[model samples]
Target: MTLPEKPASGAEQPTMAELAEGYASKAGLHRSSNGNIDVLKSAGGVQGIAESVLPGLVFLVAFTITRDLPVALIGSLATAAAFTIARLIQRRPLTQALAGVVGVGLSAWLANSTGKAEDFYVLGFFTNVAYILAMALSIAFRWPFAGLIFGFIRNEGLEWRKHPARMKAYKIGTWVIISVLVLRLVVQVPLYFMGEAGLAALATTRLLMGAPLYILGVWVAWLLTRPAPAPADPGTERS
Candidate 1:
């Protein structure tokens, strides 16, 4: 019996490379025809931004007007559901919508159980902290997560790890990302602790910082980590 055919030599890539490609794919970054990173597409574009921000915006507005937790929660859930339904109608992927639903549902549950509106933002803090620590660890390991992502997007594959300059650029990019998360906490955590009184401010900051700030931070990181163009060949004749 033929031993299971050994995988083709070209198909034999390290598992880390495979994982990094998958992670980068999910980042939604794409190169434009001119080879610039499409920051809006990376942030999911207009549809993606609306999907992420609208539910929270709805909840905040509803809570502010009615000052009723259940009503605000229901409004948020309904907004999330509406996006899910829209995706279904458009035959679009439901991953973003469904994730939004789950997040809003969890936040609603937390706030409802504790009978404090501020708890809705608590889970976000934990999530940010988790990301900060994970990215920090990746930097410490010299496997800066930004390199994994940018390398994949730039078609450099995993070779960036072998180049010290590229590795340093990616590390700085990763730190730029870490700073964004840290900024979110620094600006919002105080508002979160202010309890319901601060709910409005907390929710406002969350909306402002959610997708817009993320896009800005990622754009900056992408710029900072971009590879320098190769020097022009002196022997090449000009047209």
Candidate 2:
């Protein structure tokens, strides 16, 4: 989680291309089915999903029932903290649990401060928008996110971009990611603008589109980037 250090003046600094390749390669190792499953388990799996969704659910339900911001915010923060504590007691990695606590805590703070329930979803809405723009820009520049990632994973360097087939595959994979993000915004943005009801809907949308959709996106990317069949040698063909 620490930021990278600056290279010394006399040292040859890594280019952005090299850094991007390294990052993509590292990311690919974690995007596989087994790797993702392990991540899910480390994150507390089904229980983790519930832990993530329940705090917001509690806030929404409490607000709907009593119309009290303090009560709702407290309920959400308390639930998130409880989940984090439970994860710690179980000796599981705290990254996911801590993230849940931080996210819920921040959302509650924003909503309470603004006296607007919709502010709870503002962070997530902006996050999705940021992702969409990043992915789109990468593809438009012909350095598609998926391609860059898998190429580095395979240690193929920038060579994949020179091949029309591989380039097309990566482009398609990047589009899959873009499509999911766009769909999320399409469904949730209007809800984000809807006031109290929108807040509730936005929370629901966030839960629905969270990890499951991400896993699906990974699967689609893998399918598109799987190794292609090698061409037959001319000498092997009948004369």
Candidate 3:
């Protein structure tokens, strides 16, 4: 484990996009499957790697690089839970509720403190928030992103039979993120020795990248569920 295990510090992680892509692969009519067995399928070795650990490590990596504001880490989890509440309002999943809080908090963060209301840094803050939220949603809800692979399946990918998958993924994501955090906190080894300036650059870039990554991830998820066509009409129904 390292210092970047938490969300606030893990901006420099390279795999954030990769890991997030898995979840993003299931959007719209193609949400993550509610099959607890599938998620737990990879319980040993390869499966173990996929289910028990990798997910959290990915988050920790992002959290590690995105380091700086401890508040954002708490913000990440709080906002996620908040999103679940929002979904409950509309009868959606916890991820939807998490999205709401993310949107609000991030929109505000993006609003900027440019000494005047005139300075609307729209792209800077909100974009970053969006990216973090996309990845965070997976963490918040606890599901494995099967990408196009899972898309072929019947269930739109959403709705885990049990909420246990949510906790498993969350714990896994959080654990890995925590490990990265330990490295940064204990050894104080940064991706780059940006000192104050380098560290600042890392966070800013992460915010910038977060949006596009989210868009791509969501888009891919949709493409996977573009809707298979029905078979040709049969003559039997010609009454």
Clashes of each: 0, 0, 56
Candidate 3: 10-residue stretch with minimal lDDT: 112-121
Q: For model 1, which pairs clash?
A: none
The whole-model lDDT of each prediction reads 0.87, 0.77, 0.38
**Candidate achieving the largest TM-score:** 1
TM-score of each: 0.88, 0.73, 0.26
Q: Can you write out model 3's per-residue Cα lDDT over 1-239, one digit (the tens) per residue?
A: 56654665647564533443444334322223442213222212232222222222332344456643333334444544543554467574354344444543443354233321111123333344454455455555554333222323433334332545433433453334333323332232242243444443444444333323333443444343334476767875674
Instruction: Give me the displacement of residue 196 in model 3, in angstroms.
Output: 3.7
Q: How well is each residue in 1-239 modelled by candidate 1, as lDDT tens digits?
A: 77787889898766654554455658666556665677777677798899999999999999899999899999999999999999999999898899999998999999999999889889899999999999999999999988877887777878999999999999999999999999999999999888888888999999999978977888899899989999988778563
lDDT of 1 at 223: 93
Superposition TM-score, candidate 2 onto the true structure: 0.73
Off by over 4 Å in 3: 1-76, 95-195, 214-239
Q: Which stretches of candidate 1 lie over 4 Å from their true place?
A: 1-23, 237-239
RMSD of each: 4.1, 7.8, 20.1
